[model samples]
Each structure stands twice: as structure tokens, then as C-alpha cells.
Target chain A: MSKKNEIIVIGDYTVTQLEKLSEEFQTIFVNKTDDLRSLSAASRKNIKGVAFKGHRPLEFDAASFDLLPELRIISNFGVGYDGIDIQEAIRRGIKITNTPDVLNDDVADVAIGMLIALSRNFLNGVNWIKSGEWGKSGEMALNRTVSGKKAGIVGLGRIGCAIAHRLSGFKMNIHYYSRSEKSSAKDWKFHNDPVSLAEEVDFLFIALVGGQETSQFVSKEV
Target chain B: MSKKNEIIVIGDYTVTQLEKLSEEFQTIFVNKTDDLRSLSAASRKNIKGVAFKGHRPLEFDAASFDLLPELRIISNFGVGYDGIDIQEAIRRGIKITNTPDVLNDDVADVAIGMLIALSRNFLNGVNWIKSGEWGKSGEMALNRTVSGKKAGIVGLGRIGCAIAHRLSGFKMNIHYYSRSEKSSAKDWKFHNDPVSLAEEVDFLFIALVGGQETSQFVSKEV
Candidate 1:
């Protein structure tokens, strides 16, 4: 197949993801922008769509986009597309897409796991058992309780809402601060600002998106 | 205050727990059976109730019960009263109580947290970010999804049921095995045997009570 007919896959993707992508499209695999530049002119020209994976900044500027004149869309593997120059893509009439809500459950699960692990002192308990202290010193001290505690979620977006939903099972009183009030989460207390949200809760979960708008979102004041 | 009028607190209790107990009653604190014997005759006779606080076997045999003739009840601090000789306590006309259902939420929270942590490779992710490998290695490899996977709960009692309830929020298919099927969890699949339950799920959580009856509950076969 001609190089121009292929898709470009950039970043550190898993073997399975890469295999799946390869099965579907004749792909030009590159780890970074430099690798993309290193590819032959024909291979770069043939790239019509870019499957951008990883968390690193892609810097999809005009010059980079111009390298692939046939590029129609830049499909980001993760929800955050801060690395991609959306303004540049828009100016050049290219469509930009991101995998957003697809990771909400996974992200929420991790957040809840971290909260529980921390509050319950799981590591301490494990170490106590492993070090034979459980046998010698007897039962470890009682750790803090997690359920019924107040939890504040910053940025009640897809992942935040999912986390709130799971935490509700723990009987936590949910409080949140977002750009605007989420009507769907009417039961949860809404704080107009991050400071108010933090002040009202025992546990605070930050789930804001990355990029200029959300950088330093959870500052000292918050 | 007479030692005979005090409550006997046996086990490795926290300073806070001991302080709390002391505030309520003149507590005769002892961690082992030998310590109980070390108590003055007057102190032993004054004990009316025993607040047993650790996993160490209390060995409330006939001889020990005879030592505290005024002993009326043995209130165990934890959910499992395995360390207490129930039959001996019954024969001696002494009451035994365990703090049941109080820790269901915490136990369930830990179980769910562990499941999510393992499936999502949370430790690996933390290490990646902590070691500065995230910047060097870019994105980590994709991890297994927690939601939509099958989970098996062994001994569907209080903690097991709580775990199942939380796993349901993750959209996990719940499977369980107990002495008898739990009618309340009709929606969850019941395995007549633990082996069958283990065969059907990706994650298996053992929430059985600690005792001789449940000693080898999760055997090699299961």
C-alpha cells in the first residue's frame, strides 16, 4: 500500500493496542515528534489520521500539521488533549477527537481505591503482618474510618461524577465544585469555589482536566 | 476504687482505647493470660465484665473463668470472637458478645480497594510517577479493567455481602459461595461450592469469619 494511505500512531502504546491498530490500518509508528520527522517524506505524507497516545505534549503546531497535508483528524487516546494544539488544528480545518468518558470508571475506581487504601492504612496493616509485628506486637492500632466522611470532588466532570457515585456506596456526603452546578448531582452539595469545597470535606479528590485552563487548579488557596 | 469493682480489659489495646476504657471503668489491663494471673486476688475477684480486645486466644477455660467468679460477660472488641471459647463460656453461664456488623463497611471498602488497585496496577503507576519514569518512559502500559469483570465472594456473610454491594457499583458480575445461599442476594450467582465460585470469577474475595470452621476455607482446590 502507498505510504499516504496509512495512519500515524504516536506515543507509547501497549503491544495489544499497537497490534489492534496495525490489524486495522497500515500504521506509521512513532514515539515522539522527532520520530515522526525521522520517517521518510512519503510515509509522513501518506498519514491521513493520527492516533496520539501517551501523556507527553505532542506540540501539534502548524509546522507539524503541515508535514502531513493529508491529515484529517487527530484522535487522542486519553481524555485530556492538552498536548495537542487544538487551535492550530481548528485553523487548518482538521477535526480533533479525544477518548473522554471511556475512562471514567477506571479513573473513579483508582480514586476510590486510593482513598480507601489511605484511610484504612492498608500498607501499615500489610507491613505489620509481613514484619511479624502482628504476631509479636499483637493487633495494630485502629485506623481512621472512611465511610460517612465528607468527600469533595473538584471538577464534577464524567470521571468526577463516577467517583462520587462509587463513594456514595460508602455513605460519604459528597460535595463538589465545577465550572457550573451539575443538575444531575442535585443530592450532592455544590460549592461555588474550590476553597469552600475543600473546607467542607474530609477527603478531597481532584479530577480536573489538564491544560492551560486547569493548570494549578488545586492551588494552595484551594 | 476497689480492684474487684473494676472491668478487666484484656489484649493489646491502643493508648486511646485504654484511656477510653479507663474513663468508663477502673480498668485492669492485661495483654496475656499470664498477666491475668499476675493480678492481685482482689483485682481478679472484682472483675464483672471482660473487654477482650485482640486476636490472642483469651483461653477463658474453666480455670480462668473460676478465677473471676464475678465475671458476667466477655465483650469482644472485634467482629470475630474466635479467640473466646464459646462452649466453655456457655457451660459456665457467662455471656459472650462480639462487635459484629460494625466493620462491614471498612472491610468491604478494603476488599474493593484491593481489587481495583491490583487490576489497575496502582502501585506500578505510583512508582512510575515517583521514579521519574513517567517523564522518561512516557505512558505506562494499559492495565486490566475492573468494571465488567466477574468477582467471587467467599462466605456471603456481612462483609461478603457488603463487598458484593460495592462491586455491583463497578458493574461486576457477582458470584458467591457460603454454607447456604443468601436469599437477599438473589441477583448474584450462587455457587454451591467454593471451587465453582473460584472457577467463574477473575477476582475472589474471602470474607469468611475467622475460626476453626473457616480455617482452611480457601483451600488449594478452591
Candidate 2:
């Protein structure tokens, strides 16, 4: 009952994303990667494109690729494409695309937020106020100051650069670790390794891309 | 028996602060403004410098000023001195001083953190992971993007300017409201009032100095 050239959508997407995909293609939706095997043979054969929408490692090796013989593309929704086995896709002439730089600001914002929340004891302060302890206790204990402190960023990618930019406003001395030094990030101090970066700063922020290359990157020594 | 020459310490200071003060002066520590009356007349006569702490309005009016005829200085611990009756202090020939520019970075960091937490729905996302609902639910609902949005700042002072500077990293269009436009903040758009600033931006950060002048500055209209 399906079309001959429909697209396959893997992972749990928002209703809007699903609706948009539905309007564009005769789509086969699967909530989990394992559900792909359960799809009818006829449906799998007709799959031409796959839209991936989750952070889970999508093991699209040669075996999974063989199931969708007509598959030409795997478009990932997020910036990281580590989930997909790129070498395997390349061998089979399958083109892979991911949305990069789209979430840099959001990711950076979260990094800074978490940093401030931790240094400022925001949770404890909020609880103290909500519990009516503020009125009773007179004044809360002073928290650690955030600005003019040293901050280290792991993996100076798009998100890391954005975070460093934000920290500049706080007068923080920026230190970062990346494979290669970025020419545009001349203002910040570059560390050849994560250990040096961590040792030099009061706060360490990890912004590395998720994949085998970065697995255990922040190891025991780091 | 205490020394005739001593400092009057007001408010509930930390033990460390009290210890430091004790080393410097023969101190008369009063937790509350009301407790000033309980001081012995001998101790009252000896008081010269008053280290004022906390936000409670220090009612150093003509009547209270009469109590401490020898009072020379009201040194405020924090930047804002709204609690102290400045006019009465001036009339009584008392010098006043406060620590400023020390807390700008911390306050601005907190403002940005709260904004990100709200826009990103960080609390819900955190709860989902901590409650083990992430394994069951697959993924939480998507949150609104924080960057490339508009931000309004009320009272473009030290903290407000710092917040605007941080938002600029997120590629946000900055709009601010202040009585007079700041020369340094020329890059940002300035609104005559808070109402217009609120209307133009997705998020509004208030960084006004607390006092009678700005008591209801961010009113219903804003």
C-alpha cells in the first residue's frame, strides 16, 4: 500500500518535523533503529532517503545499508554525524549530510548557563528563597564570583568559540584545546592538550563532538 | 569592659568578616537595626565607624543620628547604599562609602544563565535525565533556540552592559533602556523607556540599582 520511492525517517521527531516530512514524501516512520528490521520487505526496498533525528549511535554499516539497496542519502538532523559510519557509507556511494553550526549558539548558551549555575550555587539560592529561609536567615552565604576567572574549553569548535566569546564579557581569561589552533581565535590561549587547559583554569567546559575520535578524550589524566 | 574607641558593626555578617573586623577594631556588633537601642550608652558613645551590611533600610535619620553623636562614617559593604538615609547622613556630616564594580560580572553572569535556563528548558531536560525518564522516553521535547533572538536590558549600567555584551556573542540584537544613553554602548539600540525595550526584545534583563528611584521602574507597563 506504499509508494515505490518513499523516504525512511528514523528516531523520535517532533510532530511538526514529521508533518513536514510526510507532506514532502511517502514516509516510513520508525521510533527506534531496531524497528527498521521489522519494516515490510517491500517498504525497505522502496526507501530512497533516510532522515536521522537522534543522538544515539546510528550503526548504519554495510549490513544495514544492504537492506535499503536504493538508499542514496542519510540526512542527520543535528551537527554531529558520528552516529553514522561514514567510511561504510562512502564505500557504498551513499551521501551523508548533517546540520552543522545550526546549534552552536544554543550549545554555547547551555555551557555558560551550567557554568554560572554551578559557580553561583543557583539551585541552593533558589531553594533557600523558596523555603522561606531567606527571610529567616537574613542573608545567604556569598557565592564564588564568576567573572575575571580563568575558563578552559575542550574542543574549540563552533560551540566552543561561541562560549569563549560569551565568557569574554565576564572578563574571563579563555583557554582552549583543539587539534589545530584556530586563526580566528587569536584572542584566546590555545593548549596543545586538555591537561594543560584544565590545570590552568578554575572551570573546564567540554564541547567536543561525540564520536570514536573523542571517546575517552577527557580521560583520567585529563 | 570594652575600649572607648570602637567601630559599630551593623547587620548579620559572616563569621570570617566578623573575625577580620575584630582584629581591626574594638567592635560593637548588632545583628539588626532595632538592636542598636540595646547597646549600652557607654558603647554607643564610643562608636565612630559603622560598617553597614544587608538590605534592610538603615534608618539613620535625625533621631538615629542623635543617638550616635560621635558617628563619623557609614561604610557600606555592598555597592547599593539605598538602605542608608543619605540625606540625614550628609546633614550630620557623616562620610559614606560603598564597594562598587566588584559584583558586575557575577550579576551579569547570573542574568544570562537564568535567560538560557528559561529558553532552553534546562530544568525539565535535567529532570528527565535524572529521573531515568530519558531511557524510557527516548528524548525530551525540543526547546526554543536562544541565539539570534532580540534581548532588552533595563538600566544599562555595569551589569546591564555586561549582559548585553554576553548576548552579542549569541548574535542577539541588543536594545536597552536608561535615562541617558551610554556613550560606550553606542552599538546597541537605545529605547527611551522600558516598555518599548520589552516590546522589541524576546528577553528582558533588569539590572537597575535598587532604591526609591528604581523601586517600581519595571512596572506593569514594562
Candidate 3:
């Protein structure tokens, strides 16, 4: 019953920082070893927590966890937990954590950049720029204004909320479909159905969390 | 002399929906010309208003205005009006306008996108995606959480405000620098001098109007 917390960071980068936090730490640093079976065979004892990268495909043999009964936490490195089995982890009483906010602005920014580039036909402009279609050149891109464009937000979670807030001043008529009304969300109009949100939105922002609920979304081409 | 108004958009694409407001019978429509030089030449006649692409460079000859005595309103098609000469237009008693509110979401979106792409190394991920690095073997970029990072906003205009609003929920400490304290700004602490703002900011956002005032800002490599 030693209280020194044991953490098997599936990657070493996060643990390097976590180790600096220094609250009596034991970390099993795992970095880019493709075969998890070998690591699982090597590390099936005294594990208290596990942090994993979702990029690589991994599955823990039931026998591995059967031996490591002390494991308590599972921190998914990125925002998604697709790499792990949620129901099994839940049954095992393991708490899962993720990195969410670290990328909100970046993703939001890219979405808008694409919106501007697409609606304004920056692709065409890029062609124009390279071709030296300047002062005496013919017609440029006949682009729609990004300001008054109709926008639909796919999910209204933290990232969705961030996108909506970033879009607040742009004068876009924003439509969103969320699990429930944000009662506090004042600027955007909410819809219960996805099809209805799609009808009016010229620009659609997809921010759905990856899991059983949202895996198939955008499959139909929103 | 008539108080009646007619606007001709001098660009490839015009806001055709703006014509739906014709039911009000206030603003009249002249034909849109995709050619900028021809459009400027046409502005000399009865066309009183013209909108140009603000983000792209436009040719503004004094000779054109020397011909356009009736031109009173010059509206830009996008948010950035760096191309237009405000002083010369003002001297000729021409009022300048831009599609400001429309691009806030778009600009904030790009800014956030750049921040994310830079911070999380999403561009590097893009390199991975482009080079088949994701499917093949490569060193994947792992990022820290965007939450709780120090955020500094350079200006508090509409787009800047939108950026701040979107970032508010991420739980980051917000700091802003403006020429003066914004009357309607909320929650965030303000710093008058950018030196103070830059000293502590981990991520800085540029939202100010481009000019000598904002030029060479964040010039320090630090």
C-alpha cells in the first residue's frame, strides 16, 4: 500500500512535464513502440494510470488488465478516446482524461480560413496570382462575402462553443444542433435536428466528438 | 440633382442578395463590371457608389477620380482595406466603407487556425497527412492543451472582440492592448502599453488596423 502514484504514460513527452510536477511519481515511459503486445507482456503489474496516443491502433488483451488490477486512470493524449474501449474501461472503474482546449483556436481559425478561401474562391486567386493576372488582367474571382454567409455549427461542445463565439461579430445567421439547448447561448439559434440545420447553412462547422454517437456523422456529406 | 442612389460593384462577384432590398426602393442598382479599370472609368458618370476588393491590391489612379466627380461612396468588398488610399478619397469627399462585420468570423477563424497550426504543429500534421506520414512511419507531433495558455489580443475591434469572446471559455488568462480602454470591453484586464502585454503573453493575436501604428509590432524574436 505504498502511496507513490504510478503512471504509465503511453508516451514520454507528456510525462516529462508531468514528472516535473513532482508529487511522488512513478512513470512507465512508452514512446512509439508499435507493438503494444510486447509492452503489455512486459508491464502487467503495479500500473496505476495509463496515458495513450490515439494515433496508433492499440488494444489491451483482457489478460493484461486482469493482471494489472491496480490501474485507475486512462488519459487519452488527444481529444478523442477512439484508441481505447470505453465500456470496458468504465466497467474497470478507470477514469479517462483528454487534451481538449489546447487546439480550439487553431481548429477554429482553420475552419474560417477555409470558409474565406472557399467562398471567396482563393483557389482561383492563387491561380491568378501565379499567372500574373493583375491590373490589365481579366475577371478575378466572383466571391461571396464571408460576413453575411449562413453558417451551421455541428456540435455545441467546447470547440463548437468556441467557433460560435469567434463567429459572433461576423453577422452570420448561425444555426446549431446540440444534444440540448445551451440556455446560456444567446447569439446562435439552435435546432434539434441535423437536417434542418443543414438546410440554411452555407458554411458548416464540424466539431463532433469522436465516438459511437458521432463516428458516422459527415459520412452523408453535410 | 437627385437624392436618389445607385451603386455599381466593381469586381467579379457582387452581393446579388443586396438587390433583394430593392423592395425598399431606396438604393438603385447599376450594372456590375468584372473589370476594375473599366469599373473606375464607369464610376465617373452617374454611378455614385462602388465597392472594391479590400484584401487584394487595387489600382486607384488620381486620373480616374479626376474623371469621377459624382463618385461619393467607395465600399470595400472584404475586411482589410489596406489597398485603398483613405486620404485621397477623403480629399475628394468620397466616403469609404468596407464589409467589416462579414469577415470577423473568417479572420478570427484564420488567426485561431494559425495559432493552432503553429502551437500544436498542425501544419506539421498536415505535412504528415500530405506526405503519407500518418499512414507510413514518421514522428507524430504531440501537443499540449490549448486551455490555460496565456492569450494576448492586440486590438479590440469587432473581429478582435469576437476572438476574445470565443477564447473566453477556454479558461485562459486574457490580456489586451489598445490605444485606449474600450468602453464596452468586459472581464479582461487591459494593458495600455504593448511592451507590458508582450512581456507576459505566450500567444499574441494581431487584430489592429494595419498602418504605421501597428507596423513592426511583435518585431522582437522573443
Candidate 4:
């Protein structure tokens, strides 16, 4: 039979996703990034593209990349492609793509939710009620308020901007740290450095892209 | 000495609050609403007002109101005065006051937080991470999204308006049920009835006043 490898899907994908991908392309399935090594030379040669899913690191070292000579592009399912070797892909004339802005709203919602949860001690309140402590002990202790508080965004990118937009409705004073101030920053205060941004705000949200350069951008010092 | 009674400070009062009230006016301290009957008739005659605190009901029946003949006003410490008998207070020429709009923002923040926590299954995710299920079972099953969803406010009062303002940032289609269309409700759809509003929205927020009329406003049918 002919090699069934126009595309290789790497990492964990739902059955529906796998079926849809197979219906759309000639595909080979691999459970992990390192599984590419097990593919036969003929099958590897037929693989022109990779569809990446899941959060696990996709370490495409030179040796790993060399295994698939016909590889042309890697389409990452999520916004972050930090695990992928960008310089190696560029050097090998391989294209890298990611689904950017697709998750901005969901991510921003989570960020706001987490912020409110922490500020209001939602888990503790739930636990208090569940454990019958609330009935035994009058009321849960009052926690801090999120609205009208100061908030800082570590990276004023698409996701950070989305979070800042939501915080504005809560009447928060927005501050951000970015390499350069964005026009969208508007009335929000911009701090050129993360340290200053962290010092000035009650809450700091880290939204920088995941990569070696940004791995510890909000470090211990910050 | 003159009768030291311009106000009867009832229910739980912090030391600081008791001291503040003492400094402001001649005050009589009563631990409970029923304790009003125990006050000396001479002392009760001098009481002109009441500083009501705590969640316990301040039942002002004819007999209770009759205990303090000079009682003119009940200044409640919270937004809700459901426990105080309004009709009896009004009939006795006694005024009832509450701290309305003081907690609108905080209340709205909590409402949104609870909404996000339920929609995103935040408590379950926390348990998954804590129980180490995330490591063994991969990802948590995806939950519902709050953004771009329809939200209905049962009462478009101050707190409800604040919630709608925040939900607008999430791009939710705002719908409200109120006795009449509020002038402040600009683009939001107004439903004269709560049942119709409940039918059309993904999330329903009840901000109605707590009393007999609204006790079961969002009941089993909703």
C-alpha cells in the first residue's frame, strides 16, 4: 500500500478531532513528540506537515527534524509555541504556525475569574459552607474587593489587553509592562519595566508568550 | 443625670463601632431586638432612634414598637431590611433606612465570580489538580463558556445594573426583568416578566429585594 503520510498528528487529541483530521488529510498518528523516531523512513519521507496538539513540549531538535526530510510546516493547536525550536525551524526553511487570538476571551475570563476567586476567597467560602462551618460560625470573614483596585499586566499583548479590558469594567486602575507602549493602552498606565509594574498594582497578570526569553519574565525579583 | 438615651444600639456591635456610636450620641446598648422590652420604661422613653446591625430579624410588631414610644427611625447597617416590619414601622410614624448602593460593586463582583466559577468548573479543576487527577487523566473535561452568552438580570436595580455593566465587557447579551423599563437600561432587552427573561438567557442573576414579594421570585419554574 502507498505511504499514508501527508500530515502527522502529534500529541493527545480527542477521537472526534482525530477523525476530522483524518477525513481532511492523508495522516499518520503519533502519541508523542519522540514517537516520530519510530516511523519508517518511507513513512517519514511522505510526511509534509505536522498538526501539534496538547501542552507537552514539542522538542524538535536538529536530529528530530532531520528524521522527516519532507517536513514543511508545524501547525500548533494552541496560542503558545514555546516548546517548538523556532531558530531550527527557520534555519531548516520550515514554517511554524499557531492559533493566536483564538483563546483571548477564554483566557481573559479565566484570569478574571481567578483574580476574583483569590481576592474573595471563593474556595474558602465554599468550604466553609460545605463543612457546616458557616452555620456554626456566623458569617465567613470578609475578604478584599476586586473592583476599584489597581491591576498590572506583565505583557500588554492580545491576551493581556483582553484582561485589561475586563478589569476596566470593574473600575480598576490598569497598569501594564510591555517592551513598548501599545496605542491600545489608552488611559492605562504603562511601566517600561516589570518591577515597576508589579510594585504599583494590587494584582499582576502575566500574559507573555511562553518561550526561553519569557520563561521567567516575572521572576523572583519582579 | 439626664436620661442617656438618644439611640438604642441593637445587635452585634464591634468595640470600635460601639465607641463611635457612644461618641456621636447618648446610646443604649441592647444585644437583641427582643431585649428592647427589658429596657427600663424611663430609659426607653428617651430612645429616639435605633442603629440596627447583624442578620438577626428585628421584628417590630405593634408590641415591639410600643416598647419604645419615642423611637423615630431604624437605621439598618446593610442593604437589605427584609427582617424589619416596614408596614408597622411606617404605621408607627417610624422611618426605615438602609445602606443601599454601598455594596453594589462588591456584590456584583461576587455574582460574576460565582458565575465564572460554575461555568468554568473552577472548583472541580482545583480538586483535579490537588488530587493529582490531572497528571493521571490528562486534561479536565471542557466546561461552558461565559463569554458571548445570554445573561438575564431579574431585577435591574443598582446591583443588577453593576453586574450587567461588567457582563457587557464579556460581550454578553444583557436582558433584564423589572416592573418597568429603567431609563438607564440603554441597549439591554427589558422583559416585563421574569419567566420570559429566564427562558431566553444562559445565566440568570436575581437582584431583587429580599422579602415576601420576592422571596420565591426565581423559584422551581425558573
lDDT of all predictions, in order shown? 0.83, 0.84, 0.67, 0.88
The CAPRI classification for model 3 reads as incorrect
Q: What lDDT, from 0 to 1, does candidate 3 have?
A: 0.67
Question: How good is the docking of model 3, as DockQ?
Answer: 0.19
User: C-alpha displacement of B60 in model 1, angstroms?
Assistant: 0.8
* A138-179: candidate 2 lDDT, tens digit per residue: 567878888899999998887888899988877889999999
Give the alpha carbon lDDT tens digit for every residue of B48-158 in model 1: 899986565646567778789888998888777767778888988899988788889887887887887788887787778899987887679879989878999888888
What tens-digit string does per-residue lDDT give for candidate 3 at A1-222? 576676665554554566663455665665643434456645656677766664544454355356557878876777766666677778888787888776776566556555655666655665687888865676684557666668899898878877776566455678898988888787689988887888878888888887666777865645
* Order by DockQ, highest first: 4, 2, 1, 3
Instruction: Kindly report which residue pairs in candidate 4 clash with one another.
Output: none
lDDT of 3 by residue, B63-160 (tens): 54655568887777666666666778888888887676766766665555455545665546656778887677756866645656789998888878
lDDT at residue A50 of model 1 (Cα atoms): 90
Q: What share of the true interface contacts does candidate 4 keep?
A: 0.74
- Positional deviation of residue B72's Cα in model 4 after best superposition, in angstroms: 3.0
List each candidate's DockQ score: 0.64, 0.69, 0.19, 0.81
* Cand. 2 Cα-lDDT: 0.84
Cα RMSD, each candidate: 3.5, 3.7, 7.2, 3.0
Residue A221, candidate 3: C-alpha displacement in angstroms: 7.1
Q: Tell me, per candidate, how large a share of the native contacts it keeps.
A: 0.74, 0.81, 0.17, 0.74
- Candidate with maximal DockQ: 4
Q: What is the lDDT, from 0 to 100, of the residue B189 in candidate 2?
A: 96
Candidate 4 docking band: high
TM-score of chain A of 4: 0.88
Model 2 regions lying over 4 Å from their true place:
A1-6, A26-48, A54-58, A67-70, B1-5, B32-47
Q: What pairs collide in candidate 1?
A: A3-A46, A4-A46, B4-B46
